[model samples]
Target: MGTEGGHGHAIDTSIPSAARMYDWLLGGELNFEADRKACEDLLEIAPSSRELALNNRWFLERVVRFLARERGITQFVDHGSGLPTRPNVHQVAQEVHQGARVAYIDIDPIVIAHGRTSLEVNSGTRFIEASMTDTGRIVEQASKGGFIDFGRPVAALYVSVIHCLKDREEPAAMIRRMREHLAPGSYLVICQLVSDEERVRREVTELMDQGTDGHWGRVREKHDVRRYFDGLSVLAPYLGDVTHWRPDSDLRRPQKSLEWVEFGGVARIR
Candidate 1:
């Protein structure tokens, strides 16, 4: 990602990237004015956008720790892994299982740019700037990169990003392809924006669809999300608002947005 950790690329600050926007929402300093404006617009629609991001992130950290410490997963392939934030996948996993290896996937140039310095923190990490839909490419790169092992259980994290795939893109189908490539006992951790309110779904979907400044999908219902786990052996505390997907502690941040939530859970491939 980003020319192997050296040389800077020209980033078009006029456009807003979802990764940058997310980093901004998390109170990070990796965003531009366009991203800030986009977040403001998003907040106008979903007032609890920041809280929702925080909750999803907390869920991600908690689930990774569980997988590494309890479930014994060491390798990870983060689909659409966004910009580097505090306690990333590798950092969290390594804390539980030292020498945990991770392959970060993202097509965003911004993410690619930052990943060179931020993600490649050790020999245990790698970054691939490719479509998450390209499971074959992901596997090949991860295997050839000499970090991730396909023969071992790998946690493929979709965490909060599937809403970027349009209906015709078939998010569920992409997951099935991932299952085909991954070893059994490997985990598929997924969660994305979902809402029961018809208005929230429509408006938020439309807003993100038009202004994400890149490929984007609609906010769907819970039923639509369940389709992604149709054949997988879902883990305990199964599919629901990720805010409640194993709280890990009562100290977690609260997301008051009933209008929309990051919904889905972890499932294992048999």
Candidate 2:
């Protein structure tokens, strides 16, 4: 198998990383012990986090298919692309459009390591080790690397990742910068971990911040997430629970609850 870097950095298993924790929650084997402990602590506070993560992942797959197949978008940039699991962004998008190009960006060492290995063999994709906060460089690199054509309609995805931004990081502004770079026909797909309960939001955010050793972002309300799409046109089933966004008939929900659900949608640039 093609590979990039392999565990180049010292594996700091003392503290958790949102990426690894998420991998664990999704039943992936890329996580470390710190990730498991952090996830356990989160479960104590919000028992539905694992379920929410799974649903959000499914939501991402749905958006990729919709954009590649239904909307005919061929270029994609998945911000904060964690460790690659089954049916990754490029895999899903390329399934519908073989010419699809995907650029996965993330600063986490593990993600970068795994991304390099998982994507090196895919001709239409590449992995960039960068922070979402560095939108200018990301845009420049993506354009110069020949993976993305800003002149064409590209689907930029921020699935379940915005919460990793602290308020000072200006996640919205970064997205706005990216939006300004896209063509009118392009789409921006954004979703984040959300909760209507203030207590749930506060505790989980605080705990995660601690669990990750301050490498965490705060969770925002559902409305705040919607604000990112203010000028765009949202598609059908607008901004409901992600599981219901475009669920497959075979994927049965064994239980239903909305305490912590994926809430976001696809919006076309106007």
Report the number of the highest-lDDT candidate.
Answer: 1
**Residue 257, candidate 1: alpha-carbon lDDT:** 58
User: What tens digits encode model 1's per-residue C-alpha lDDT throughout 92-140?
Assistant: 9999888899999987777897887877868889998788877888899
Residue 152 alpha-carbon offset, candidate 1, angstroms: 1.5
Which stretches in model 2 have alpha-carbon errors above 4 Å?
1-10
Q: Estimate each model's TM-score.
A: 0.94, 0.94
Q: What are the lDDT scores of the predictions, listed in order?
A: 0.83, 0.80
TM-score of 2: 0.94
The collision pairs in model 2 are none
* Candidate RMSDs in order: 3.5, 3.5
